[model samples]
Target: MELLLAVIPPLLCYVIFSLCKIGFQKRDQRCYMLSYQCHKAPEDQKLDTGSCADIVTRNKNLGIEEYRFLLRTMVSSGIGEETYCPKNVIDGREESATHMDAVSEMDGIIFQTLDKLFAKTGVSPSEIDIIVSSVSLFSPAPSLTARLINRYRMREDVKAFNLSGMGCSASVVAIDLVKQLFRTCKNSLAIVVSTESMGPNWYSGKDKSMMLSNILFRTGGCSMLLTNNRALKNKALLELTCSVRTHIGSIDEAYRSCIQVEDDLGHKGFRLTRDLPKAGAKALAMNLRVLLPKVLPPLEMLRYVITYYRNKIMKRSSPKGAGPGLDLKSGIDHFCVHPGGRAIIDEVGKSLALSDYDLEPARMALYRFGNTSSGGLWYVLGYMEAKKRLKKGDKILMISLGAGFKCNNCVWKVLKDLDDTNVWQDCIDHYPPSTIGNPFSAKFDWINDESMDFARREDYLPLLKKHSR
Candidate 1:
C-alpha cells in the first residue's frame, strides 16, 4: 500500500508539471492588438487634381509626353481629390527636397498617430517595452525610433527598432518581429508605427516609370499598440494568428522591377518597371502556398488539391485561364487588401475570387487616402471597422506587396465588433463613391493630341485657366 502511495504522489506531480509547461507555452504565443490609430492630415494639406497639375506645370523638365502620362495615370489610379501631401509639396517647394521637410513631415504623422493611439488605448508610453517604426524612403541620422523615444520620454531601457527600405510590406514584417519578441518577453507591450516620407523622395525627374510614384503615393500613417499581457486580453481588438512572407529578390527581373535610381539627368527617383505586376503575382503565389494550408479549413484544402490535379491532368486540352483558385471565403470573413493601386487591387481580387464586398474597403481606402505605402493596409482595415463589417470570432486576412518583389500576409481573429471610423471619420459615409473618376483626363486629354505644341508653357495658360473654373 505504501509503495503505491509513494508512486501516486510523484506521478501526480509530473502531470501537474506538464500541464503548467503547456499553459506557459500557449501564453508565450499570445499576441493581442489593443488599439490602432491612423493619422489624418489637416485640411490645408489636401492634394487635389488642380494642385497636382500646378506642380507638374512648375516642373520645367516635363514635356507634353510626361504631362499626358501623368494625367492618364492619375485618372486611373483609384485615388480621390482629398488625399494629402507633405507641406513642402503643398507649398510648391518639391524641388528643394530639404532634410527639414522630411523630418517635419514624419514628425507630423508619427506624433499625431501616437498621440491618438495613446488616448484611445489609455496606455502610457512608459509601458511600452518595444518600439518598431518603418519608413521605406527615409531614415534620418538619429533614426525614427530614437526620435519617438525622445519625444515620448520612454524608459531608458526600452527596445527600439527602425526599419527602412522594407516597402509596403514593412508593417506586416514589423508585426512578425513583435510576435517573435513576445515569445521571449513575458507580459510585454509593443508599439508599431508605419508611414512613408514623400518630401525627400519626391521624383523631379521626367522618367515616366519613376513619375508613377508621384501620382500614386500620398501622405498618411498609422500607429498600433500590441500586448502579450493576459490582463489586457479583453481589451484587444484582434489576435494575430500567423504571418507569412515571400521574397523573389534573387531573380534578376524581380530585383529590378522596383528600385530607387538616378535618371540620366542625375535626378533621383523610384522606378516601377513593367515587370512589377508579374513579380507581384509570382511572390503572392509563393506566399499563399505556405499560408493557405495554415488557415484554410480541411475540406477547403481538399477541394483545392482535387481541382489543382484535375486541371493539371487536362492541361493540354484545358482553356487558357487556370480554373478557380481556393475558396478563401470558406475560412476568412474579412479581407484587408493593400490598396497599392487600381490595377493591383483588381488583379488580386480577380485571382482570389473575392466578391465586391471583400474589395470595397481596399477600393474605398485608395480613393479616400491614396497609397500610403506600408501604412496603407491599416487604412483599409480602418475602413472595414468603420463600416462595421468585422464581428467577434471572424477572421481577417491582410495582404501587402512591397518593392523587394516581396509579398507579406497575415491573419487576424477579430476580438469583437469594431466600429471605429479612424482616419475616415468625416468621409466614411460618402465612401464606395458613385465613381472614382478624376478630372485630370477630361482637362488634359488635349495634351495627347499630336498636333499640339509640346514646349511652350505660356500657350497652355488659357487652357489651364479655362479648366480651373
Candidate 2:
C-alpha cells in the first residue's frame, strides 16, 4: 500500500510538471507587435530632380559621361521627386561628411521615430526590456542602442544590441533576434529601430557601379514595439509566426557582390557588382526552400509534390511562364517585399507570381521613400495599412534582401484590421499615381547629347530653371 501511494503521486506530479513546462514554452514563443512608426523628414529635405541636377553640376569629380549615367539611372530608378536625403547631401557637402553629421542624421530620425512609437503605443521607455538598433553604414562610438538608452533613460539592466553592416535585411534579422530572446525572457518587451546613415556613407567617387546607391538610398527610419507579454494581446497589431534566414556569404562571388571599398583614388564607396542580382536570386531561393514548407497549407505542398513527380514522369518541364512555381497565394494573403530597387521588386513579384495589387504597396513605397535600407519594408507595410488591405486572419510574408548576400523572410499574422496610414498619410491619396514615370527624363533629355559640353553648359541654366517648376 505504501509503495503504490509514493509511485502514483510522483508519476502524477511529473506529468503535471511536463504539461506546465509545455504551456510556458508556448507562451514564451508568442511575440506580438504593438505598433510601428516610420520617420518622415521635413519638407525642406526633399530631393527633387532639379536639386539633384544642381548637386551634380557642382560636383567637380563628375564628367559628362558620369552625368549622363546618373541621369539614366535616376530616370529608371522608379524613385519619385519627394524622397528625402541627408541634410549634408542637400547642402552639397557629402564628401566632407563628418561623424557628427552622421550622428545628427541618425539622431533626428531615430529619436523622432522612437518618440512617436512610444506615444502611439503608450509604452514608456522604462517599460522597454530590450533594445535592438540596426544601422548598416554608420556605427558610432557610443552605439545606437546606447544612444537610445541614454536619451530615453531606460532601465539600468535592460539588454541592448546594435547591429552594423547587415545591410537592408538587418530589420528582419533584428526581429529574428527578438524572437529568439522572447523564447528565453518571459514577458519581455523589445524595441527595434531600423535605419541607415546616409551622410557619412555617401559615394563621392566616379565609379559607376558605386554611384547607384547615391541615387537609390534616401533618409528614413522606423521604430517598432514588440512584446511577448500575453497580457497585452488585445493591443497587438500583428503576431510573429515564422522567420527564415539564408546566408550565401561562403561563396566568393556573393561575398564580393556588395561591399564598401575604396576606389583606385582612395575615395570610399559602396560597390554593387554585376553579380548582386544573381546572388540575391540564389539567396532568396534557398530561404524560400526552407520557409514554404512551414507556412504553406498541407494541400498546397501535396499539390506541388504531385505536380513535380508528374512532370518527371512525363519527361517534361513545368509549363513556361506559369504563375509562381508553387501557389504561394494558397498560404500568404499579402506580400511585403523589400523595395531595394524597382528591378528587385519586379523580380520578386514575377517569381512569386504576385498580382499587381500585391506588388502595389512595394512599388508605391519605392516611388515615395526611395530605398531606406532596412527601414524600407515598414514603408511598404504602412502603404498597405493606409490602403486598408490587411485584415484579421490575413498572413503577410515579408522578404528582405541585403548585403552579405542574405535573404531573410518572416511571416506575421494580423491580430486585427489595422488602418493606420502612418508615414504615408500625407500622400496616400496621390499614390499608385496615374503614372510613376520620372519627370527628370523629359526635362533633362538634352544632357544625353554628347555634342554639348555639359561642364560649360551655363547657357542651359535658364532651361533647367524653367523646367524645374
Candidate 3:
C-alpha cells in the first residue's frame, strides 16, 4: 500500500507536467527560413567574351565560329562582369580538375554560410534535426551532407540527405522534403545547403548546345536554415505557406532538353536544347494550376473562373487562343523567378504578366551573380530585401527550373524584417543600377505594354492598399 501511494503521487505529477507542456506550447508546424547567405567568388575569375575565348582556345575541339557563337550568346545573356570561376582557370594554369576542387568550393560556400546562419540565429549544429545538401555536377564518395555533418559536429542521430542531379530546383525540392519531415517531427531544425561546382563540368568540347553552360553558369551557392519550432517565429524571415513541384521529364523532348552528355571527343558538358524554355513554361503552368487555387484569395479565383468561361464562350467566335491568363501577380506581391538565363526569365515574366519592377530583382541577380543554379533564387530574394522593397506581411513566390525539366514553386509569407548582414552587404549598393536598359531593350517601355493587361493592372494599386492594412 505504501509503494502504491508513492507511485500514484509521481504519476500524477508527470501527467500534470505533460499537460502543461502540451497546452502552453504553440504547435505551428509550418517551416520557416531563419536565414540564408550566398557565396561570392573572387573577382579575377570573372570572365568576359575575350576571357572565355582564351579558355576556348585551350580546347582543341572549339573553333573561331564556336567562339563567335559564345560571344553572341553572352551579349544577350544579361550576365555582367562580376560572376566568378575557379583559381586555376582564372590564372590560365593547366591544373587537372580534381574532386578536391569541387569539394573545396562546396566547403567554402557551405561552411561559411552555415556558420553565419548559425551565428545569426543562435542555433547550434548539435541542435539541428536534419541536414540536406544538394549539388548538381559533383557527387563525391563521402557526399556533401556527410561533409557538413562531420564539419559541424552535428548529433550522430541527426538525419542527413544528400541530393544530386536535381539541378537548380534541388534546393526548393529540399525545402519540400523538409516541410514533410517537419509535419512529422515537431520542434525541429533543418539546414539546406545548395551549391554547384563547375570544376569538373567545364566543357572542353565544341558542341554548340553544350557550350552554352560555360557562358552562363557561374560559381555561387547558398545555405539556409529552416525550423518548425514555434519559438523561432520572431527570428524567421518568412513562413512557408505552400510548395508545388512539377516534372515533365516523361516527355521525351523535355527530358532531353537539359542533360549532361559526353561529346564525340569524350569531353563532358551539360546539353541545353532549344525546347528548354517551352518545357519550363509547360512545367510551370502545370505546377501553378495545382498551386494557385490553394493560395489565391477567393475573389481572385472567381475572377479567373469568370475569365475561363468567357474564353470558352468566345472560342466559338475567335481564335481558340483567348484562354484565361494565370494572373499570378494578383495573388503574389513579390516574385523570385529563377534567373536561369535571359530567355527563361523573359519567358516566365511574359507568361506570368510580370511588370519591369516585378522582375527587377531577377534581372539584377542575373547581372550581378549570373546563373548560380538553385542558388540564384536566393540571390534574387536578397536583391529585393537589399532594395528594402520587402515588408512584413508581404507574400513572396520563388520559382526555379532544373535539368529534369522540373518547375518548383514555394510560397512564403514574410514574418519579420529581412536579415541581410552577410551576402548583400558588399554589393547591394550598386544593384538595380542607375542605367539599366536602352530604349530598344526589353526592360524599357514594358510597363505600358498591352501584354501586361492580364496582371489586372487596374486592381494592383487597390490590392496594395488592402494589403498595407
lDDT for each candidate structure: 0.89, 0.91, 0.79
State the lDDT of candidate 3 residue by residue for 300-336, as single tens digits: 8988688778978888343333333656666789989
Question: How would you encode candidate 2's per-residue C-alpha lDDT over 1-469 as one tens digit per residue?
Answer: 9999989988999999999999989977998999999999999899998888777666667766787788899999999989999999898888899888988999999999998988878889999999999998888888889888999999999999999999999999999999999988889999999999998888888999999989899999899999999999999999999999999999999999999999888889899999998999899989999999999999999998998899899898866557547889889999999999999998888777888999999999999999999999999999999999999999999999999989999999999998998888888888789999999889888877666664554555555556666
Please say which candidate is ahead in TM-score: 1 or 3.
1
Writing each residue's lDDT as its tens digit, candidate 1 over 228-337 gives 99899999999999899899999989989989999999989889999999999899889998998999999999987887788788783534333247788788888889
Error of 1 at 236 (Å): 0.6
Rate residue 164 of model 1 by lDDT: 87
Prediction-by-prediction clash tally: 0, 0, 0
Off by over 4 Å in 1: 1-20, 314-324, 453-455
Q: What is the Cα root-mean-square deviation between model 1 and the actual structure? A: 2.5
Worst 10 residues of 3 by lDDT: 438-447
TM-score of each: 0.94, 0.95, 0.84
Instruction: Please name the candidate that would achieve the greatest lDDT relative to the true structure.
Output: 2
- Candidate 2 clash pair list: none
How many clashes would you count in candidate 2? 0
lDDT-better candidate, 2 vs 3: 2
Q: Give the C-alpha miss distance for residue 74 in model 1, angstroms.
A: 1.0
